[model samples]
Target: MEYISFYNGNEMPIVGLGTFRVENNDECKASVKHAIESGFTHIDTAMIYENEDKVGEGIAEGLAATGLKRSDLFITSKLWLADYGRENVAEAYETSLKKLGLDYLDLYLMHWPGTDEAVMIDTWQGMEDLYKENKVKNIGVSNFNVEHLEALLAQVSIKPVINQVEFHPYLLQASLNRYLDVQNIHMESWSPLMNAQILEDETVKAIAKEVGKSPAQVIIRWNIEHGVVVIPKSVTPSRIEENLEVFDFSLTAEQIERLDKLNENSRIGPDPVEYSGH
Candidate 1:
């Protein structure tokens, strides 16, 4: 698997399995287990996903099935909004760790940027403390825009290693990506396929046809080629295996530009600026 090396010398898989709406415990467990068994070394989930117990089961089973050590995998979980208070952060993280049945997480992220600046800063402080104490290997935030990133950066000591956001062919956020590049913060893609919406896009279909790959593969590869880490979620066994098969082929410069120009700045999740919380 291809990896993006961070500034601190750690590495993350370019492709990972995202667990967002996999609410059903059994299915979530099976999907994660299947993913690991199919050679996936990276797994992304959050406390709000509400299926950490099952994800833990899958991880246990997957490791046992593949004889892979815990250190061989990169596991990430997030701190939810309700758990944003300075004192609440550790308890929330421990709860997730308990449910995930893991001793520690490879990466931890603030799930969103609420409107409260102080709360956000406090939450980040907790994350930084965790990182400094070696409770987590890395810390980041999801759905944070430039303004929020600036606010958090000004208040925190260790800068967030990554900022994950909704990105796909339809919503490129080129300017934000450039800003992330300048700030030395890695930009990771959450809904890289736009909930499979990009899979049916005409340009994506054409490119897939030209490359003899599925539209999903084409879009996923496009995200990776853009230097964005992508986590394409799938519960289906075939698609889980298919999503990871993007390492062999390469998208041409022209094809990459074609996909790049498809961005309309659309979003499927809440805008960071306006979203207060759930």
Candidate 2:
């Protein structure tokens, strides 16, 4: 597995298992456990996903099965908009940590940008406090654009370590990518496969054929080569292992450009900036 060192000197696995809509309790637990056994130490979950308890159970089982310590894994969870407040930030973090059966999270992210920047900034201060207290090792934001990041950075002492967003061959997120690179903040691609929508694209299929990999692998490699973290969600054990099989090969520059040129600036998830829940 490849790791990208955040500006804070903390390292996160470039690839992780995204538990978004994995609602079945047994499947979620099994998926988490299987992922760890499959050499994926980084598991991403969120409060809104409503599967943290099962994920935590899987972590326990994976640990007992492999004799791996808690520190051996890089676990991440997110804070939803409903739970974004100065006092509520820590409250939500505690609740998520408890649900995950973890003392501290490797990374914690503000799940969305929401509509109001003030609440976002206030919520970020709480995260900064958690970092100071060592309750969470890393803090970041998801679905945030450059404007949101700039406002939050102006009010807070620590900038976010990364920004998680919907990025795929269809939604390349180029402008945001350039800004993040300049800020020394890392970028993570959620729904990197575009909900499996891009897998059938001719360009994607063509490259997959050329590399002797699945279309999913080609899309993932595209994100990896772009220097962005990729989290492709799956519950099937075989698919889970297949997703992790991306590190063995690489996409050439020409192929990456072909995938990049397929961009339509589309999204399969909610827009954090326009989301009104917060």
lDDT of each: 0.91, 0.91
What would the TM-score be for candidate 2 when compared with the true structure? Answer: 0.98
- Candidate 1 lDDT by residue in tens digits, 1-278: 99998878899998999999998478999999999999999999999889999999999999999999999999999998989978888899999999999999989999988989999998888888888889988989999998898888787789888999999887888888998999888999988888887788889999999999999999889988988999999999999999999999999999999998987888898998888776
lDDT string, candidate 2, 112-192, tens digits:
888888888988998899999988899999999989988987788998999999899888888999999999999999988
Clash counts for the predictions, in order: 0, 0
Q: Which sections of candidate 1 miss by over 4 Å?
A: none
Candidate 2 Cα errors over 4 Å, as ranges: none
